[model samples]
Target: MGKITGFMEYERLQEASEEPQKRLKHYKEFTLHLNDADAKIQGARCMDCGIPFCNNGCPVNNIIPDWNDLVFHGDYQTALDTLHSTNNFPEFTGRICPAPCEAACTLGINEDPVGIKSIEHFIIDKGWENGWVKPQPAVVKTGKKVAVVGSGPAGMAAAQQLARVGHDVTVFEKNDRVGGLLRYGIPDFKMEKSHIDLRVKQMEAEGVTFRTGVFIGKDFPADIINWAKETISADQLNKDFDAVILTGGAEQPRDLPVPGRELKGVHYAMEFLPVQNKVNAGDKVKDQIMATGKHVIVIGGGDTGSDCVGTSNRHGAESVIQFELLPQPPEEENKPLVWPYWPTKLRTSSSHEEGCERDWAVATKRLEGKNGKVEKLIAARVEWKDGKMVEVPNSEFEMKADLVLLAMGFVSPVQSVLDAFGIEKDGRGNAKATTDGEGCYRTSVDKVFAAGDMRRGQSLVVWAIREGRQCAREVDAFLMGDSVLPR
Candidate 1:
């Protein structure tokens, strides 16, 4: 530990954020990074716990304490190195990850946890400003070609690792740009697209080829959401590339199968989110879904729902209301019972802080509309008894809703790609692959592998990176009989 008694001396300090009113005017990152001194103090708060659960708590198993000590000692470059060792994109995780590491921090049992995410954001931003982040191209070529389908965090990480290890890696994306979800699904207000651009540039310099607007499947039907200019068959990819890794994320959104779900104003969160991101990137979106001056109802209380709330507020919605099917959790978690683990408690995101009427334990019965457009939502109070949810008697209610955004989360990956490749699917419809044992990440078909949401279902960016790195290692070993890449 850099400072033995620092945890006792310093209270947790978070990064400053812009006022909601001021920040709502533009689509840009509003949270300011912590200054060096404050970051050092926050880093110094890391106690010398016998076991660093924060490391395991992090999906990518980030080397937390080491970087904290480095930051405390003013070793910024070393801190960046340590931070990047396990996690390929600390900037992404620093910005969007919920920081399970902090929840499992030793000090968090009794006091505020060490501000690990803030310190990480500081280190990465400083690294970029100082020109510390650069291309790390391999000196020798392996002459083996690997195709990574999907250019999201997982695909990007796998391609980078494979390229760095002297293998030819080509990333295929169905969108107009390299970043799959990061470029479209995420709003610029949370994290500007420039971060993804910088990483794309770095990867390109590292000898990784990015083929955007290229769909990897047998057919590119007009019914699909792919904006690809060309289509490559799965058979052709298998023959051309020595190995193929499917890192495509789960895109099949869960739908609310209720009356009037086909109404004009009802749409999936994805349908609404991507348009705004495309508009932010200077692309013209036709008939884009907007919440302007409309009473918006966001169903499903999760990150996606919160994002809808923020976006709707930004669009000058008359009002925004979020609904949750489950009962409300306690504002504060029972720390004694869930210490060193992710606790079940109410989490208020910055979007919620912006302004939203949130309700829990409510189930939507149906949507009523006028002339095929949503006008009102019919809902009922639900009570959980003996692990079953039952509707309360005569508790039916209705609310005005000109727009409804379904944010209940993704159910599975787009099945067309999986079917085209003849890959086996799990019970959940995700690409079936084991994380351990022989032939790890290997799909039912030969020379085919799966990872990230494609294999494990919808998950965090950090987890996607982890799966990508491990899958890359598995692919490398499958090719060369050995790999130096970390798992």
Candidate 2:
């Protein structure tokens, strides 16, 4: 370790962000990255823990300490290289990932953990500023063609990996552009789309072909099929490519099946979130959903609910309230002992701080509206008994709500996509493909494989990238009887 006493001397520091009032006016990233000196200090805080649990803690298994040391020593290029050794896109993870690695840091046993995410952000930004990030085209061509359906992180990583290893790779997306959820689902304020554009350019230079606005399945959801400029049969893709990989996301949103569910003011979180994103991308949306001059109620207390809260605040909502079905988590100090592994504690997001009143253990009984437009909500307090939720007697309440957003989360991948390719599905309706042992990532179909949300269901971008990389290795081995790509 370059700085043996550094961890003891330096306290952990996080990146800074714009004040909520100032950042709320525009849809752009507000969090400021660490400068050279501050990043070095944060890097110094990484203790020389022999086991380095942070490595395994990361879904991509990023070499946290090596890059941390490199950043501390002012070798930014080396640090950037180390960061890219595993994670295909540090910029994405740096901005939005919850930093599970920090939770697993040995320093986090008592004191604060190292700011590994910030250091990573600094290294990648520096590399881009110095024009160090470049494409590496394969030197020799392999007489094999690979097809990756879905241009999300998982498909992107797999295509890039296979392209670097001399395979002719084609990535297909049903959307008008690439990046999938990153391009549409994520708020531009969290991560700008330019990052994805840059990566696409690099991948293009590396002999990867991206075909957007093309639906690869014969049958698709009506709303989804409308986004595609053209359609190609799955049988055609199977016939054309030597191997195929499905990396589509889980998109079937869980619905709130209470009274007044079909009211005009009620909408899925996906319906509400992506329209704003598209408008931010300069797409004109007809009859756009706006929270201005409205009292909005967002259901579910996870990231999607928080995102809805943030977006509503940006739309100048009159009042915003979020409800959670589970009891409120304890404060960090009062959290259970099984921590660091899985932190079950109160967590407040940046969106919550913008402007929101949050409640817990509240279940929606029904929604009341006037003239087919939702205007109020009826709910009751709930308590858990024997792992079952029971409503509290005489605890019913009513509230004004001009709009109700269902942010309860997705159920599974679109079954139509799986059925189109004749792939077996797990109980969760995800593409059934294992991640270990022989035939890993290979679906029941002869040469088709699966990864990311299509295989693992709804998950983080980091996990998607990991699945893509490992799936590429197995595909390589299956094609050539051996492979050199890292898992």
Error of 2 at 309 (Å): 0.8
1-487 in candidate 1: lDDT tens per residue? 9799999999999899999999999889999999989998998899969999999899889999999999999999999998888988889989998999999999999899999899999999999999999999999999999999999999999999999999999999999987778777788999898999999999999999999999888655442366888999999999999999999988888999999998999999988998899899899879999999999999999999999999999999999999999999999999999988899999999999999999999999999998999999999999999999999999999999999999999998888899999999989999999999999999999999999999999998889999999999999999999999999
Q: Where is model 2 more than 4 Å wrong at Cα?
A: 223-226, 333-336
**1-487 in candidate 2: lDDT tens per residue?**
7888888998888789999999999999999899998998888888879899899889999999999999889999998888998988999998888888887888888888898888888889899999999999999989899999999999999999999999999999988889988887888988999999999999999999999989888777753323788898889999999999999888888899999998899998888888898899899989888999999999999998999999999999999999999999888742236545757778999899999999999999999898999999999999999999999999999999999999998899888888888888899899888998889999999999999999999999899999999999999998999999999
For model 2, give the 10-residue run with minimal summed lDDT.
Answer: 333-342
How many residue pairs of model 2 clash at the backbone? 0
Q: What TM-score would every model get versus the actual structure?
A: 0.99, 0.98
Predictions in order: lDDT: 0.93, 0.91
- Listed per candidate, the RMSD to the true structure in angstroms reads 1.1, 1.2
